[model samples]
Target: MIKYFVMGLRGFFLLAAKIWSFVCYCFKRQARTVIQHQTVRYEVIQLSPLSKHRLSMLKRKTLVLDLDETLIHSHHDGVLKPTVKPGTPPDFVLKVNIDRHPVRFFVHKRPHVDYFLEIVSQWYDLVVFTASMEIYGAAVADKLDNNKGILRRRYYRQHCHLAEGSYTKDLCDICSDLSSIFILDNSPVAYRNYQDNAIPIRSWFSDPTDTALLCLLPMLDALRFCNDVRSVLSRNLHLHRT
Candidate 1:
């Protein structure tokens, strides 16, 4: 009777093992079927624009701006700005003492300059490197900044290297990091020292309908992402100047 009982117990264990194996096999087969019929889909999601505080988190490139002819056109009392209207007032007047003589200048801002500065300031740390005198550049810079404090720094004529009777900007004096620095000037000679980093803008001389500054937005926007500005400014600017 004891031997028969042991045989029955062995049979019962075998049957339970078979049932467990069958259950596992069914589960695996069902999973395989589900995977085979699985449908994959992709969707693009749009995000909101970054805030000024958020923009600060990003490592920005340095953009050096030229003062005269590039951003604004200023003429002294001795020379008449041919484009100026008979009765139209200048944007602002600047008077500075030079050589023991006080000189007055009529200043006109380039079209869309305010909007351009507002946008670029968000992407780059703007710096003014003008060939103009310190007293004059500082006053104009103040007008451009308009208390927004967007311009990070300023470099004047004294800071420039005198070359061939012309003042050319040395970007190294402003920022030594060549890879991330850009010089936006109307004059080629100003950026002759750093051709790779130069962004040649048209000479602005009181053209109200001028869209040059606006056209540069797309290029400037695209450049902030690059590790080296020369990689794109040198190659892609020709393709997308429109």
Candidate 2:
């Protein structure tokens, strides 16, 4: 009889322990769910839009582009020669001078750049900013102008102070309104200074075969619709703010 009583006591203790463990597990799961819900609610509240007009204006105007690797390909082999096709006029050569040395000018338009620029020019004022020398930069700018009519203003190497590197940020000083400015460059270093005013894009080398330019159209469209930086931030504040 004593042996049977001891066995019963052992079974009752095991059952009580199991019930206590289950209660603790339920409380932990509920706490995790509450934390997850709070995080989602905070994210939703941060991204709300500021205004319709600012959004519309940002969608309409201004694109500042980096010139060298972004627009033209600089080859390590040698300066590129302009290609002319059969049945063309013998004198139909593209002439461009860089640092007083006459270099052949070639139009290596990216696969959708012509079409993308045509659509964007209808809305945004386009500018070119490059660390390249004035002569070479102008040559590329001229080509863009002749082909797409999109290069309205150009900032060459001379416009920037090389020693400080931070001078690149000075581009913002020229803008009357920070909301209207946008920059696209391959250098993360340069874009870091203008994170508030610029959008960094990967360099598109000048191979007629490459097709990355098409991906930029939607980004341009987004900028065209963005009127104020505040609106973009308001919608993405959780992601953008430090």
Best of the candidates, TM-score: 1
lDDT of every model, 2 decimals:
0.81, 0.59
| CA shift of 64, model 2, Å | 0.4
Q: Candidate 1 — which residues are off by over 4 angstroms?
A: 1-58, 80-85, 236-242
TM-score of model number 1: 0.72
Structural similarity to truth (TM-score) of each candidate: 0.72, 0.58
lDDT of 1 at 76: 80
**Predicted candidate 1 versus true structure: per-residue lDDT over 159-239, tens digit per residue:** 988989999888888778888898899888877767788888888876666778778887887677667887766763543
Q: Count the backbone clashes (under 3 Å) in each candidate.
A: 0, 11
Can you write out model 2's per-residue Cα lDDT over 177-229, one digit (the tens) per residue? 76777676666555455566665555655333454555656555555554475
True lDDT of residue 11, candidate 1 = 97
Colliding pairs, model 1? none
Q: For model 2, how many clashes?
A: 11
